[model samples]
Target chain A: MLNFAPTQEQEEIRQLAQSLAMEQVRPQGRSAEQQGDISPALMKTLTQTGLTTPFPEEYGGSGVVEAVTYTLIAEELGFGDGALAMNIIGSLMGPLTVLLAGDKSQQQHYITPFSDASRGHLQRGSLGFAERTGGYYVTEISATIRTEGEQYILNGSKRDVIHGGQSSPRVVLVRLEGTSGTGGLCALMVPLDIAGARVSLDEGKLGLIAAPSAAYTFENAPVSATCMLGQPGGSGVLRAAALYNILRAGVACGTARAALDYAMDYARGRIAFGRPIVSYQGIAFMVAEMAMKLDAARLLTWRAATSWDRGTGCETLVQEGEAAQYQAIKIAKSATIDAIQILGGAGFIQDHPAEMWMRNAAAME
Target chain B: MIDFTLSELQQAARDYAHQVALEEMRPISLECDRTEKIPDSFMWNMQRRFWAGAAGQARTQAQEGEEKQDNILSILSQEEMAWGDAALSTAIPGPGLAAPPILSQGTPEQQAKFLGPYMDGQLHWGALALTEPGIGSDVAGMSTTAVLEGDEWVLNGHKHYITNGARSDLVVTFATIDKSLGREGIRPFVVPRGTPGFVVGRIEEKMGLRASQTAELIFENCRIPKDHLLSGRESSKKAGFKAAMGTLDATRPMVGALAVGIARAAHEKTCQWVQEELPKGFSVYKRREIELELDEMGQELEMARFLVWRAAWMADRRIPNSKEASMCKAYAGGLVMKVTSAGVRISAPGENSESRQFLQKWFRDAKVFDIFEGTAQIQRLVIARRLFPEVDIP
Candidate 1:
């Protein structure tokens, strides 16, 4: 109803996440950037927020949380550290398949563990969508899915998968051979511990330094029919694309927000050419433009999230989500780049997080 | 305590102002621009509505210590007015730029004698003469001179781009008695427009804001009574230039809000055009892209508005808002140009369309919002200076 005021619960959650970010995630991310290691401490802090729990009431989740709230939460996490936020969202999105489409039995076994703290440490779930070749587009993925009697065989490998080398059940996207439309692409939950699945030596990607990623191969990894989400024969392309876009947009918005806040604080203090550099129209206008794009990205991200929550049709949701993703990527990359520009030579150094954010935004995955 | 939602009362005032802008100002906007002269009746209509918004006990009641929010309401109302016609908003009968410095620096007698003329009966005007041909945004670099002889003061100066300087009942002229003392010796005087030797110089020939007058004022041996001198306290006398700068804390937000309004108008018009007059074969993807663009403009407008509101709120609360004020001015002033330019692109993809001409006019108008009342660069410098108050950068 044309309101910018978040609900009490949303505000509370935002504050909690903000504190976690400022106290834990941001520092952890900055320190971890040097080592290329994901801090288990940051992950534990995230889990403690109860956000990592699957969207099921019976399993101890807040139960079917609103997509808008999730998007807002994702943004706050991003504000803490983009790469770290990406890791958390990617992990959460991995199990989202089972939560949204799996049978009751699968929810109890696979998703309930993350919700029940009594069940020990939070079990990580990895969603692998990118491949070794082509681009980041999920539709253009090269992996193949085949049907054989009571099992499904998945062939081909994925590169740059977040937490890929880690021991977790990975939700892999595959193009079905000899299928049309909705039945074309398929998503399968493959436990990497099984035979015919191999994890490669850690690549420890330079980009998105907060999330440690590696390549993995699947040579005809057999998956039971029960492991498949939705109807035994289902469409995955639009659904996957929509969800991916929503999550990415949220992360991008958060990063842009952080970049703006940092740039403003710096502009206030940084003096150059006998006055504050911010006094220069060229720099001031650029900062203003940065703020404009950042705000735009956030609004688009929120709208996409709202569409995902309230939209009755897949087409509408997909369209909004895709638009959000396109804007988010542009905004994040530009905002971070402009932020670095505002920071000048200091931006290129490791002391400021702008360089790190610029790298993460450049990836735009 | 922190929220972006407007109160019901604020929303109602906004709605009323919005209606007036769309229904009243929008109709005569183009004519006003082309003729370079706003209709007199239209301005009176605006002043009455603005006065009702928060000026006094009219239209609404104010509880003690609770936010009267007159400053905020004034800024928001300016936004609505600008949305209809930016030039018309400037033309609204009031003190224009002269009110701030005079109200702050002028003595009680000087204030009543000078400000009363503009606030009362016949809708007169007052202007501040500060900018010079060689000096822009440099308060201390003014070349005007003032000398005291017996009980009268002789003023000599040239003020360029002075708003309402040609027609105002009084012009607040800033002149230094000693050039060597620079800012310290500078004092403001109430030079009645028709005072001896106070002549109106050339009017600016401009690209946009043509509907509003930009006058060059010349004061050669202009003399005024000693009572006309705005000598306040010793601290204020010492803090002359700084006090004049303080006036911006009250008014920049209004300018910022106006900029946001202009951007919103262009954005709304473009969105309507895209939906109602879709170019042939505008694909679903392209439609979605346009929607995204519209969303971007909306977000930017909202962000700029919040900055304005925050700055205005601080001004009303008497909180020091130099930093906040400058930030708002910088952000809104810069984005309005881009937002309008984007609108021009979408509504007139062919490079020349009727819709493009409308938006192009707005884009031109938006440029002045950034250039005046301390340019965007000047605002940024103010914000930076606050941040680095301790750092004496050479």
Candidate 2:
């Protein structure tokens, strides 16, 4: 009774995403890093494939894919380039959340822009929720929202927004006035063309240079009443917490895979004392340990996502939370660090992606 | 590609266990757990349900194939017997503790004669005497010796921590038959009760599994016929160790299954207690703690069950299962320890505490699962050795 097999479609998507990442994302990722902006071109291509809109066709996106599929792509992209992968995977959360709970009209208005094949691949929107002061907890959102009639004006800013200003349409999570903590926060669709919302880029981030990290200013930005996602006043904020846990787990796994790839390749190629470094137990054991965690992480992540898709039960919720987020994050942090260690001094330089991977993992944390 | 479904055979085993657990044992489980002992009559009732009775009343007539029921007879009817206090389950004769190695390596005639008393309702205590005083993890390092004397095999050594050793009518003693071949030189011999040189030295006062007798068995010139040798192949001492260790690969999962039963008892008790017993406004935080612990324990139990089934299934299928068995044993054994520990933590010392009766005993019982059927460290060593043959196990 415990056959947990993935369908062929999931495998196909995973393969396609992995190939795309290795071919297009990894190479261009470096340039994006140098330019200090996440590549909009890459973002457009992802949206074009309906990769960003993994929801049902009724919601202006393909509903065939599960969260696991998105996670696979995210992990692969993370493996290729952490920053770019974050931007790409992080962008889909908006589309995903809307698909999950959005009303039909809102979905058509917000989702169709990017899903339209005729648009020749639009830059899918991004999610801007994390702020400057809060380290890990999402409870404190400095962005303020004031309601006047049907409209709620967003006044505060979001710092460290991945691909902040570049994505055409993005979802900004803001806390409404007269409410405290996470309970008051509501997700709103914010168009980049809005005059009051301003983006100030943070330069020379230690890692994921390809991912644009910035400080945003939303002074009296007006948002329509229909833009609010979920039940406006109730448990809307709490209901959406599972998505972050799942997707972040995917990011962790994908990047860990990439780290293993680099480390393994290096171990095989580099020789010392008339043998490959891999011949040494010191290196081989680390590689083995990495492989073990990577395997376990994959199983745990898949279990979490599959449980989500199946609507198994509440018993699975805490399990999914631990496996998908906590374990994945730990693995991502550990694997990247180990990958860098395996490479020794060569990994420390900007030329190799090892240092970059380590930094990106830090960002993931 | 492995079929993970519980097969009809396994379902039958589980069904038998379920019926016995529900009808006979469940009612008295709380009482037995509290008293930490099961009376002889209750044990006799269990013997009627399976094998290992007092007089010579075999539980059931011969089954279909009927070559001989020795193998089945020797096995501790573990599924059914585990129903009534697994600790007490280990105490009952015939199928309880002595049959594993006998079934694994016992010669055909040896099995029929030595393992016969239990099936016939003649109360025969059986013990698998393997672990030595200094050699809990390292079975190969057993200092016990068996020297050949004419047509008799004379055993001169001691076995420490033999379950049911003090009362067992038969002892399946593992000894070094030939020192030169190391592990290959070891072999098992069936030493009947009241043998001149064989003695139950001292019984240890254990923390839990309190009703089962765990004793040190000493052998001094204990003489048995050459035919008493369990391994018919007549291999070296090194081969004997391999044979004994292999039996453990099969039985370790059974040990893990026992742990599973004990943990299930704790989990089910705690779940019922938490739901019905907690008062209003009694710290939602504490309730949350119970909830989370239960959830985690449930997950661990499921995973442990999967491991146990996988190991047992591999064996039943006649597949070489040393590695899979090791994995199952390690994973399940570790999980049982964790679950029992959490059971004690959440259920102790509160008005609504559901863990009042059995958690402490289970906590103690849990450690034995990790220690007895090859320590956790040993299982890991076996896995690491198998997985990376070239690398020295750390």
Candidate 3:
């Protein structure tokens, strides 16, 4: 069973995603970043592909909930363009949380609209999980949720909430009242329009410009108790967290792979000392190391995604998922830096995507 | 379909190697480094207890129609053995670098003559001589010369930094017949021990891996029968150089695994140190920093191992793995250096204990992983050439 080959269907899907990435997503990456938003037309094209709606079919999705498939698509979209890929994948955080942890009624109310083909692109969801704290570790969740009669009072500030300003139906991770650590962790789906909730669009970000992020501050924002994603002690929120890490890792792998490809092409064509610079061990080795790191990161990401889809134990899922993200982010940062190095002066100019990628990779970390 | 599970045989190989590393290598690791030699008795014991049995079983399995999983099995065992102590693991008796070329390109007679003794349950070493006094990496520019005179060939050159060269029973030596022909003129001559004028020159004093001897071999009018020429005279003139590269392709992943093993050892040691030595009530921020450092080390090591395994897997399946082989070597080589250096940094402020000493030794040993087999730069060139096949790289 120590095989490295992808299944036939997985390979086919990978190819399809790759084509969309190369032909559609990659081309618009720069413009989308410059504008600080994905074009409406391009978002429509991506939405029609059902890549953004991976919920259960009964909830108006393609029902492709396999983590492996999601990762594969995430990687391809990442390869096409980091900002665009982030924009597309970031939009799914809220709905995926609802689908994973919400009761049936919650899913129908929040997730069903994502499956509506006509208006799905506009029905974005965001996850407010990260806080300005120690790290991305879930045990670091400091946001608080308290039950009051038939409603829940939310009070906390969330940082790095992707699409927080633009998306409705936000799913925020919070610790229950008077509780500490992971034992009291839970998630609640809150509408962005709710009173006492404020969303501030973050500006001057170093990268992922197209997939803009915002910070959210909740001041006693009360919502129906039915909005709770899962039971207080349930495992659904944990699973969703693991899936988010894996998907993000997939995106990093794509970005690293793209950086390597671009660097290789540039090195192959640039002439110096009467030969392509790639012929020199100096340039060639850097490119090679980039390629190696990219592949290594991709394999880790894939393994984590596969383990998730196989319904392996939660420990294995969290460990692999964390490792994958750690490596993917590191490699993405290094690979983009190498890409810029390979491009020389052109790498620093906006005329090339290497600089953009370098920023995006940093943002990913 | 992608999976990371090891088969039963691989698991056994890993466990058995780990046990040997734990019981045998760790005990003598520092002593060997201090003395700059592995005891002959140890080598003999390993030959009889480990290498001979393993090699003999492999032969028997091959004769019994079992598929060869040599590449994967070798890497798995090498990683574990190296995890014990890289120098002692490398110094274990058997054909070290000399097996690949002889097995792949040697004639039946040559194989019988050179490799047959390794199966006799005796302590014997086999070395491959490619590096020389003035050249390294630039294989085509080697000045070692082999000239034919009747049925015998004369070899004259100095090969240094050769692993196991001082004690090798037979050395697969590379020498060019025509200086102007570059790589095409290279020929591999099997020079047996005690051949006239074949001298073991200097035994190097090194920074690390001191248990494994690094010898300088001098061939001053050394003579061997033409029959000892690997692949014989009728084979393609390019075969010798190709075989040299082929051996590198096969061994780089093994070297990568060895590097990973060393990193694993250092990382594990650092982990234990962190658990036991850190003061109670350490600052939360500092603890978080250390935690992130440890996490990075663990992730990087896993990534390096996966790269090594994938390359070995490709080699076992007989896929063209030159690029992947270099990838693992380059990545693991750089990675080991980083991890070992970090290991030393993280474990600092401790008493100069045995564990701390080993950490320092490992840091020293990690450097050569990037320098030998193929330097990180050389591997990159190989990878770049493969990536852009349309553009010729000299």
TM-score of each: 0.72, 0.68, 0.92
Q: How do the residues B1-394 of candidate 3 rate in per-residue lDDT, one tens digit apiece?
A: 7777777667877887888889888898889889997887788778875755765575455446455678888898899988988988777888889999998888888788888888776778889999997889999898999999999999999999999998999999999999899999887889999999899999999998988888999999998998888984336779989988989989999999999999999999988887887656678898779878878878888888888888888887788899999999998999899989987887777778788898999999999999999898888888888888998877
How good is chain A of candidate 2, measured by TM-score?
0.84
Error of 3 at A205 (Å): 3.8
Off by over 4 Å in 3: A56-60, A166-169, A177-182, A272-274, A279-282, B52-68, B107-113, B232-235, B278-288, B392-394
Regions of candidate 2 where Cα sits further than 4 Å from its true position = A4-63, A67-87, A102-122, A127-164, A172-188, A192-222, A225-244, A253-300, A313-319, A334-359, B1-37, B41-127, B145-156, B166-174, B184-198, B220-363
Cα shift from native, residue A353, model 3 (Å): 2.7
Candidate 1 or 3, higher TM-score?
Answer: 3
- Displacement of residue B14 (Cα, Å) in model 3 is 1.2
Model 1 bad stretches (over 4 Å): A1-37, A45-80, A92-121, A125-206, A212-332, A338-355, B52-65, B102-121, B147-153, B225-238, B274-299, B342-357, B390-394
Against the unseen true structure, what C-alpha lDDT does each candidate score? Answer: 0.74, 0.67, 0.85
Q: Give per-residue lDDT, candidate 2, residue B162.
A: 88
What does the lDDT read for residue B293 in candidate 2? 71
Candidate RMSDs in Å, in order, are 6.9, 7.5, 2.9
Q: What is residue B79's positional error in candidate 1, in angstroms?
A: 2.1
**C-alpha DockQ for predicted model 2:** 0.10
**By DockQ, who's the top model here?**
3
Model 1 local distance difference test score: 0.74
